[model samples]
Target: MDTKDNHSLPSDDTTRLADTNSPTTANPAETTGSTTDPASTTSPTYTGITEEFNTEDIQVVQVGSVLKNRFVLEEMLGRGGMGVVYKAQDMRKVEAMDRDPYIAVKVLSKDFQANPDSFIALQRETKKAQQLAHPNIVTVYDFDRDGPNVFMTMELLQGEPLDHLIRRIRPSALPAQEALSIIEQMSRALAYAHSENIVHSDFKPGNVFLTSKNVVKVVDFGIARAAKDSDRVVEDATIFDPGSLGALTPTYASCEMLEYGTPDPRDDVYGLAVVAYELLAGSHPFSRKPATYARDLGMKAERPKEISKEVWQAISHGLEFERDKRTINATQFLQEMSGPRSGRDSRFPSWAYPVTAAAGLLMAVALVTLMFFGNGDGQPEIVLEETSSLAEEQRTRIEDLLEVAEVHGLVGRYIEPSGSSAYDAYQQVLALHENNKQAWEGLHSLGDQMVVAIQKLLDDGKQDQAEILIARGLEKLPQHEGLQALRESF
Candidate 1:
C-alpha cells in the first residue's frame, strides 16, 4: 500500500524554538501583503522582521460588508497583480428567486482604485469579459465598485491552474506529444476569444486552469482588451498599460507582438507557438540577452528538432516572423497537429528522435516503507530488498507519484509536501541508479525548500545558524537547487 506519512520529522539538532503564536501557513506574509497598492499610505510591510505573528496582519475582509453588500469576502484563495482573489458568497439577489450563492471576489489595489485612469481599464476589460459565456472560459458574473474599492465578481473555479499543471509536469523539455495536447486546447481558447473580439493579452500557462477530470479552462480576463481602443491608463503614461493590453510575457511574445504597435489577434497565435516550443524544448526559444548582444540572431523560429524534429514543422509555422507568413490561426495548426507526422506516433523516426528521448527519461523513484515512526532523521522506515515483488510494487507507486510531481514542479508548486516528497522518492531511486535524470530532477525541487527554510531562519533572527546549516547541505550536494540559489545571493 502507498504510505502517506512515512517520512520522519527533522532531528532536534535542526529544530528552531518556534513561538506558540507564530504564523503557521503564511511565512513572511507581510512581504506579500500589499502587492498592488502603490500609494505609501497602505499598511506597513509585513517583512517578518518586527512583527513575527499578529492577527491584524492577516485580517479577513468581510466581503459583503466592505464592498457595499455586493459580495461577502471569505477566506483568501490566492493573490496576484491588481488584487487578492477570495472565496466569496454573492448576496446580490439572495432574497429573490433562489440560486447558487457563491462567487469569486477579485479586489483591486487601493492605489489603482483611486486612479480613475487605471480603474477604468479594469472596468472596461471586466465588462467585456462579463459578456462572454463558455464552458471552457471562466464566466464573469458582474462588476461593481464598493465606495473607493473596485472588484469583479466571477465564477470560482476549484481546480489547480494550468500554471499548476505545468509545474507538476516539468520536463527538462516536454515531449512533443504532450506539448501538442497543451497547445491544442490553448489554440481553441484563443480562437474562442478572437471570435468574441476579446484579446487575452496574457496567454501564458498560468492563465490555464485544470480540473480533476483533466478539463481545461482559460482564466484571468483581468487584463483582456477589446478590438478597439479603450486606452484609459495609457493617457496617464503609466509604467504599465493594462487596457492597451498586448503580450505581457516576454518569454513567449512574438517579435511583432513585442514591437510598438497595437497587437492583433494573431499575436496570440504567435505567443501560443512560443509556449508550444517551450513545452517541447524544455527551454525558451528566444535568448534573454538582447539581439544586439548576440550578433548571429535572426528572425527564424528556433527549430523544434532542437528538441524534437517531429514538432519542428508546427513550431516553425507558429513562430513565423511575418504575421502573414505565420499559420493563419490556431485551427490550421490544430489540423497539422493531428496528422501522423506530428508528435503523435508510437515510434518516432530519426527526425522524431529528440522528443522520443524525453519520453524514455525515467525518473527512478523508490518508496522506502519501513515499520518505524517518530524517528527524527526523516529517513524512510521501510526498505525492501531490490528483488522483492513488494519492492517492485512500491517502486511503481513511487514512480507514478514522481510523474505527478514532475508536472506539478514545473507549475510552481514543487516545494509543497507532495512536491518535495516526490523529489525525496526520486532520491531513494538515485541511491540505486546513480545517473537517473528523474532523480536529479527530484534534487532540483529542493531549491525552493532551502530558500523558504533559510528565509524563515533569517526572520527568526538566526542568520548565522541559517547560513551554517545551508552551507553544510550545499557542501554535500554542490548542484542542489537550494544551495545554488543561496550561492547567487552571496
Candidate 2:
C-alpha cells in the first residue's frame, strides 16, 4: 500500500464501523477547476471522491446549492479525509456588502456524520479550532447545520496546499532556505497549539496551506485532542474522544498515534519531521511506510547531501523513532533550526582533548566571561548584561523600525509605498544596526512573501502585474538571488 489508506475504528466488534476515507477522500477546496463556474476550466474530479458519496449527497452538494440560505456553494476547492471543502460565497457577507464575500466551508461527510458520536466530534472540532488564534492557524468561523448537513466555515485561502506544491517539485528538493522557512512556520504553529494543550493528531502536508502572501497556515484540527498533561478544564462532559475515530493519514502519523497511545506533543513533532524531510529531500524518509512498520524494519533516514550538519541534526532529532529520543518538543526543534549555528559543526568531546589543553580552554572562557561581567564592587554581583553592546538610543531606534516593519508585514505590505514598505523599513533597521537579527529575518521573509505573490500572478497569466511587482522587488533588493533568478527566468 502506498500508505494512501485511512482507517476508522468502530465502537463495536466490526458492527459499529465508521468509514472516513470515502467521505474525506477528495478535496473540493483544492480544485482549481469547477463545474458550476463558467469561468473556470474544468478539471477531472479527484479519484474515488464523488463516486463514493451516495446519490443523496451528490444532490445536496450540487453546485449553486444554498446551505441554510446563508452560504452559496459556488465551486469545489477540495475533498479530503475530513470532508468536502467548497469555495462558498457567504450570502451574509454579500448582504452586508463585504468586499471579499468568500469563505471555505467544509461540509461534514455522511460516514463521519453516521458515527453515533459524530455530532459531538464536530462540536469539539469547532470549539478546538476556534480556540487556536495564531496567525499560522486557519480562522474557523462556526459550525452550523442545514437540515441533516453540518459544515464549518473558514478563511478562504488563495494558494495551493503544501502537498500539491510538493508533488509539483518532487524528485528534486526545494531550496534549503525555502524549506527551512516553511518548516519554521509549521513549528511555530505546532508549538503554539501545544502550549494550549492541544495536539493536532493529524499533521500532514495535506493539512498545511501556504497562502499567496507566503504565510503558512495549518488547517484541519478535526481530530485534535487534548494532550495527556493538559490542565485545561473540560467544559463538555462528553466521554467520547474524537481521535478514537482514527481518520489519520498513516504515512505522516507517528508510531504512538498509530498504536493509539496517549496523545503527546511529540506526535506532532514526528509528523512535522516527516513533512520537513519531504520538503527538503523531496521524498518520505521511510518511503511512505508507516512509522511502526518502518521501525520494525529498522529503517534509517538518509541525509540530503546539500543540508548542513546542524540542520540535518535538528531534522534527524525530530525523526527519531522513539519519542524520548526525539527533539523533546516542537519549540526545541524550532530553536535548533532557527538559533545561531555556533555548535552546528561536528566536534569531538572536550574530554577527547589533552587534559592540560582542556583545562586551559575552560580557564580562558571563564576569564573572558568574568572580564565582560565585571560588577564594579570588589565582590561579584549577578548583573544581567545586554548581548549587543550598542548604545541604548541606537537599540531603541532599531527596535522601533523593526516593529514598524513587522506591522507592515502582517498586512502584506512587503514592498509597496516605496520607503514605507516592509522591505524599506527592514533596510533602515539594518542600516542602523548592521547585524540586527529581526531586520535580517524580515528581509528574507519579505523576499519569500513577494516571490509567492509574484509567482501566483504569473501563473494566473497576469504577467504585467507580475512583472511590475518583480521590478519593484529588484529595485529594493537587486542582489537577492531568489528574485534575480525569477527575473532571469523571464
Candidate 3:
C-alpha cells in the first residue's frame, strides 16, 4: 500500500469504490468554451481568459455527482479511510449562468453506505460537525443521502495536504518551538472538540489542512466519535479487517485509548503530540510500531531528548505513555504554555505563577533557618527574598519578552520560507542578549531554519509563503514600525 494513499478503507465486493485519480479535462469547452467569446482565431472558443489564465488549458475530471441535482463531479482532491473527495461544480450554475468556480464533495463508497455501522458513523459526524463553527475546523455546510449514496458538501480548499507538508519539510528536522506551535493550534482545535465531548479518533496529518490563507482546518470528522460513545461494533463493519479497522496510529495512541477503548482528551494529546514530536524532531518519539510492531522493538523507547535536550524536556512529560504523567488536560496544557514560547510575554500575570513562586520562596525560607527563629521566626524574611526575584522589574521584562518571542517564534517556525518581523524579532532578541539565559533558551526553542530551509523545498519560490510569513511577523510584533509599514505596503 502506498503510504500516501489517502483512502485506506477496505472495499467490499458489493460496493463500488473508485480509485482516486487526478481529474481529466475531457470537456474543456464546457468549462472554458462559453457563450461570451472574443474575436479569437482559435478554433475552441473558450471563456474567462485573455492570454493569461485559461481554464481550457487545465484538465478537469468528473469524480461524483452532487445533490443529484446541480453539480457534476471533477477530479479527486483527496481520498481517506472513508470517502473520496473531488472538485465539483453546479452544472446548472456554471455552464448556463456562469457562477462560482467550484466546490468540494465527499462521496461515501457503496460498501460503506451498505454497512449500518458506517451509516451511524456518518450521521454522528454530520450532526456534531454541523455544530462546530471555527476557522480552524473544516466547515460542513450540507449533508444528504440519495438512496444508497451519501455525500457531504464543503468549500473547495485549493491547497496541499498537511501529510505531504510534513514529509516535504521533514518536520522531525524542524525546531522544537516551531513544532510546538503547530501542535498548539491542533491542540486548540482538539480542545474545542473535547469540550463538546467529541473525539477525533483518526487525528493525523491527513486529517489536518492548511489553506492558502495559512488558516488551519482539522478535517475528516467522518470517522470521529463522540467522547462518551463506545466504539461501534458492527459485525459487518469489516470493510477492512474487523480487528484492524479500530486501530489508530500506535505512535500517537495513548495506552488508555488502547486499554479502555474509550475516547479521552488525553488520547488527542498523545496523538497530536506525536505529530508535534515528528514535526519538531523529524521523527516519531516511539520507534516501535503500533500494536503488532511493538513486539519486535523493546517495550520502552528513546526519549525526545535523544534528539535534542530542549525538545526532550518540552515533549518529555507530554509523551509519557501513561496518561497521568502527561498534561492533565488541554486547559492545563495551555496554562503551562503561559510564557514566551507561549507567544506571550511573561509580564502577563497568572495566579498560578505568583502562587507557585510565593510557595517556592516560603519553602526556601523555612528550609534555610529552621532554628534561626526556632519555629518560623526568620521564615518571612527568607520567603521574601526567594519570591522577590519574580517581582524584579528587569528580570520580569526579560522573561516576558522571552516568552513572547518563544510563542511568536513558535508561530514563526511554521511560517514557510520565513523572513518575517516575527522571525527577525525573535532573532534580534537572541542576538541582543546572546548570554542572557532566557533569550538563549528562547532562541533554542524557536527551532527550525524554516524561513531559509523551505526555500529549498519549493524550488526557491517564496512569494506566497513570504506573504504569510510577513503576516505572521506582524501578528506578533505589531509595534515593529518597519513591519507595520510593510504590512501596509502589501
Candidate 4:
C-alpha cells in the first residue's frame, strides 16, 4: 500500500518472475557453478551469477556436472533473479537403488557468492525452512555447495504457478468454491508456519504452485529475503525481517511493512488477502497508483455478484489496510472465508411446540396435585404411593442432568446444539424444575462461558467447533440474544 525506497522492486510484468526458481528475464546460459563447503556455508546464493562473469561473459553448466558428489545436474529448469534452477538427479539413489530421484536445485548467482553476509543469511533461512514439514509447502531437502556455487535441493514440483491459471481465466473470476479450496490450503500452510514462528513475508500467486494432481504447494518460503539480501544492504537485519532482503513487492506488502520495514504475521495475511481478492474479482482491488495505505485508494473491491455475501465480507475484512483491523492471522482469515453453517431449517416443528405446551400444562397440574395430596397416606394410599414414585423418578432425572452438566463443563466435547454439553444438560434440568435456582444459574454461567469459547474457536479458524458450540448454546437457550447474535455474525 505504502510506497517506500525499501519496496523490493517496482510492480511490473516482471515482478511475478522475481521469486526463486520463478521464470525471469535472466538468460539460463549466464549461470555458472561454484563451490562452497557444505559445513561452513552460512548464506543463500540468491543470484546465480558469480564475480567471475564480466558484463558480457556467460558460463553455462555442463549437463553432467555433479553437486556435492550426490546430485547430478541434468538440465536447467528456469532462471530467476536469484539464480538458475536446474533439474538434478539424486545420484546416490539413482546409482545405489537403481531408481530415478529428481530434485530441483537452485544454483546461486555470482553476486550472491561475492556477498558473504547475504549468502549466509539466505543459507540460514533456507535451513530454517528445513524444519517445516507440510504437504502444502515445497520441501527443502538440503543446503550444500559445489566449488563456490551455492545451491539448495528441494522437491521438484510438477505444476504451474497460480498466476498462469489466473491469467488464463482473465475477465472471469474463478468459481467461488475453486478459489476457496486453494485459499484454504494456503491458509493452512501459513497457520502451520506461523506456529513455528516463520512468516512468508512475500506471498503471491507466482509463489503458489498448483500441481496437476490438484495439490497446492507454496514455494519460496524464506527465499524472498534471500533474493533481497543478495542485492542490498540491511542495516539491522534479523532472520525474521520481512525487509531483510530490502525487497518486498508493494502490491502484496502491507502499508506498515513498507513504511516502517517491520514484518509481522499480519503482513502475510495481507498478502493472502490480495491474492484471494484477485481470484474472486479477477482484478486488483484498486485501479489507482500505489498509496501509503490501501484505504488511501478510497475504493472498495468490486464484489462478484455471483458470490455469497458471507464470502465477500470475509474477503473485504482480509483486505483491510490497517494492520490491527485486518484479520490477525491466517486461521482467522480461513474461518471467515468458511462462511456460516447451514444449520437445521427449524429447531422443532410448529405442531411440536403446541404439543409440548399442552404436555407442559398437564405435567404442571399433575405436579401440583402430587405436592398437595401425595403425602396423605389415608386418602387413597395407592394414588399417594403412585404420585410419590413419580416424584422420585423426576428427582432422579434432574440429578442425572445435573451430573451431566458437571461432566460437560469439565471436558469440552460434543458441544453442538443437540449434542451433549453443559448448556444442553442445564436446559434439561430447567425443563424438569423450572424454579431450580442452581439450574438457572448454571445455564446462565454456561452461556457466558460458551460465548468466550465460541469466539476463541472462531479466531483459531475452528469454524466447525465454533458452530457446534453456538448451535448447542442456542438449542439450550433459544431466547439467548447473545448466541443468536454470534450465529448471525458468521
- Alpha-carbon runs more than 4 Å astray in model 4: 1-11, 15-63, 226-247, 288-295, 339-490
Candidate 1 residue-wise lDDT, 313-343, digit = tens? 7667777666788777665665454434543
RMSD vs true structure, all candidates: 19.4, 14.6, 17.8, 17.1
Give the winner by TM-score: 1 or 3: 3
**What is the C-alpha lDDT profile of model 4 across 218-283, one tens digit per residue?**
877776656554444655333223332324556667776566445678888988988888887787
In terms of lDDT, the poorest run of 10 residues in model 4 is 30-39
Arrange candidates by TM-score, highest first: which order?
Answer: 2, 4, 3, 1
Better of 2 and 3 by lDDT: 2
Judged by lDDT relative to the true structure, which candidate is superior, 1 or 4? 4
Model 1, backbone clash pairs (residues 3+ apart or across chains), number: 26
Can you write out model 2's per-residue Cα lDDT over 1-490, one digit (the tens) per residue? Answer: 0112122221111110122222222222342211010111111222232234343443467668889888999876655434566778998889899999988887765534443355665577568778877657888888887766767888887766677677677778887656766787788788778877778887877678776666678987654452211212333311222332334556777888767677788989999999999988998899888888899999999998877777788889898889888876777877676553464342322212222343344434443454565535665633423315668667755665665566455445678655445777787776666656566556755665667677778879999988888898888866455677679989
Q: lDDT winner among the candidates?
A: 2
Off by over 4 Å in 2: 1-59, 224-246, 340-490
Off by over 4 Å in 1: 1-66, 92-100, 173-178, 222-236, 239-247, 287-296, 299-310, 339-490
TM-score of each: 0.51, 0.61, 0.55, 0.58
